[model samples]
Target: MNVLITGASAGFGKALAERLVANGHRVIGCARRLDKLNALADTLGEAFLPVVMDVSDTASIPQIITDLPDNFKQIDVLVNNAGLALGTEPAQNASLDDWMRMTDTNIKGLMAVTHAVLPAMVARDSGYIINVGSIAGSWPYFGGNVYGATKAFVKQFSLNLRADLIGTQVRVTNLEPGNVAGTEFSNVRYHGDDDKAAKVYDGFKTMTGDDIGDILLWLIESPAHININRLEVMPVAQTYNGLTIAKQDS
Candidate 1:
């Protein structure tokens, strides 16, 4: 199968691209960092095609896909994995810039890629769309804010795609994960504050990018007749702490 994964420079995207190419599937790895993508290509061989892309820049997406090598143009699987959380501050205190950036990359970017690729998949009547959402979409947290909202859009958009493609063989799956470690996620969210990023998972056995890649492999290999609507996963050590209320100071 030919797979196209966004944000392939790091985190879940890079891991997934590595796993897929290793398993004999061709991968077109898309990201803004040419050096990193080129480095990955050197290791993955000719099966990996690295395309420079910024998912947040929706306007450039069409040309990027159009300019792909002949053999890589027909994408069998499209993974919307390009997204980030900009700030940990409460909504009222958060930067407007952060909110807009989250919206652009997480929501608009996903849509642009899907729009570009879905038609071909529909024409072929076969394809799989794996969207990397987050548990934050379903369960609000202290500072999830706009990041969570964007993921909620992903969840809903995926379901609506499933609905619209009811009679077709195309499948859409939203993979939501919680508390993943060994990725640039925290560092990016904390804006390069490694100390603060380290503290989030310092005491926990969090899931890794490879673990998420394992799940992606399964979803891609599932029977054509099956469409796994949504799968939410987290480490065994992770769970809800229940709701809370704060009383006024005495």
Candidate 2:
């Protein structure tokens, strides 16, 4: 199978690309960092095609697909993983720019990629769209703000796709993971504050990229008749906490 993974330079994307290629599947790894993509290509060899792309840039997306080599043109699996969370501040205190960035990458970007690829899938009546969502989409938390909203959009968009493809063989699944560690996620969220990012998982054993990759592999290899709608996972160390409330001075 030929797989296309966005944000494939780091985090879950990189790990998934490595795993898929290792398992004898050809993968096209897309990211904004050309050097990083090239480095990944070096390690994954010919099976991995490195394509420089910024998912937030809608205008250039068409070209990315058009430029694909003949062998990699027909993407069997589309993994919408290019997304980020910026500024952990509450919505009122959050930067509008950060919110817009989140919207652009997480929502618009995913939509653009899906729009570009879905037609082909529908035409062939055989494809899989695995969206990398977050538990934040379903469960709220302090400072989740726009990031959570964007993921919620992902979760719903995935379902809507399934609704529209009722009779088609194309499958859409949303993998919502929580507290994943060993990725640039926190570092990016904190805007390069490595110390702050490190503190997030200081003592906790969190989910790893490889773990998510394993799940992805399983989803892709599942029987054609089976369609796993949504799978939400979190490390055993993680769980929901009770809601918080503040009382006024009595």
Candidate 3:
């Protein structure tokens, strides 16, 4: 199988790419950082093809897909993993630029890539799409703001896409993960504040990127007739926060 993973230079995408390539599947790894992708290419060897692509650039995605080498062109699996959160501030205090950037990459980019890839899958009547979503989409939290909204869009879009692809063999899944550690996720969220990022998982046992990779491998390798629609994962240390209220003397 040929797999195309976005944000493949780091975190979950990188881990998934490694897992797929090691299992004898060809992988097309796409990301904005050429140096990081190239370094990964060196490590993963010829089985992993590193392609420089910014998913947020909606106009360029189709062209990139069209330009792939022969062996990697027919993408049997598409993992929409390019996304991030910026500014852990209340909506009233968040930056507009941060909101727009998150919207561009998380919503528009995912839509563009899916629009570009789904047709071929429908035509072939065989494909799998794994969308890397977040638990924040289903359960809101303080300072989640636009990031949470974007992932909610992902969750709904995946379900709707599944509805639309009912006749075809094409499958869509929304994988919602919670509180993963050992990735640039926190650093990026905290805008390079290493101490702040480190504190998020300082003592808890958080899920690693490799764990997600393993889950993805299983999902893709499952029987063609079976489709796991949504898989929400959280570490043992995490759980739903439930409701919160402030009490005062009457």
Candidate 4:
């Protein structure tokens, strides 16, 4: 199967791309960073096709959809994983820039990619879409604000698309994970403040990108009759976002 993954420069996207290639699947990965993409291509050998494309840039999507090499013409899976959280602050105190960025990337970018690829999938009546959402969508927090709202949109959109594609071979699944570790997600959200961002996952083990990658591969390889609509995976340490407690030394 030919697979396309967005935001393949780092984190979940990169891990997923590596796993798919290792399993002998042809993979096409897109990201804004050429260096990372090139490195991925080198590491994955001929199984990986790395493209420099930004999911937030909708205008360039059509060309990407049309210009796939012959080997990737029959794309069986698309992973919409190009998203992030910006400033962890209350809505009232947050930067408008951060809000816009989140909405543009999480919502608009997702729509653009789906619009570009869905028609072909629908025409053939065979494909799987794995949207990497967040538990933040189901449960809100003090500083979740726009980021949470964007993921909420992802959850709803996945359901609506599944409804619209009923009876067809296409499958849409929303994979929501909580508190993943070993990803630049926190650093990006904290605007490159690695030290400040590191505190969030300090106390215990958190889900790794490979964990999410394995789930994605499973969803696509399942029987055509079965559709895993929604899944939420998190480390035991991340019971729930609302269960926070302050510790006091006696």
Every model's TM-score: 0.98, 0.98, 0.98, 0.95
Per-residue lDDT of candidate 2, residues 1-250 (tens digit): 9999999999899989998998999999999999999999999999999998899999899888988999999999999999999988988899999999999999999999998999999999999999999999999999999999999999999999999999999999999999988899999999999999999997989999889988988998899899999999999999999888898999
Q: What lDDT score is found at residue 27 in candidate 3?
A: 92
Return the lDDT, model 3, position 133: 98
Runs in model 1 lying further than 4 Å from the true structure: none
Q: How does candidate 4 fare on TM-score?
A: 0.95
Consecutive 10-residue window with the lowest summed lDDT within model 4: 237-246
For residues 1-250, write the lDDT of model 4, one tens digit per residue. 9999999889989988888888889888999999999998999998999888888899999898899898887789999999989998888899999999999899999999999999999999999998989999889888999999999999999999999998899999999999888899999999999998899889898888888878888887789888888998889987764577889999
What C-alpha lDDT do the candidate models reach, one value each? 0.94, 0.95, 0.94, 0.90
73-132 per-residue lDDT for model 1 (tens digits): 899999999999999999899999999999999999999999999999999999999999
Score candidate 3 by TM-score against the native. Answer: 0.98
lDDT of 3 by residue, 67-165 (tens): 999988999999999999998999999999999999999999999999999999999999999999999899999999999999999999999999999
Score residue 92 of candidate 2 by CA lDDT. 85
Give the lDDT ranking, best first.
2, 3, 1, 4
Extract clashing residue pairs from model 3: none
Roughly what TM-score does model 2 have, to 2 decimal places?
Answer: 0.98
Stretches of model 2 off by over 4 angstroms after superposition:
none
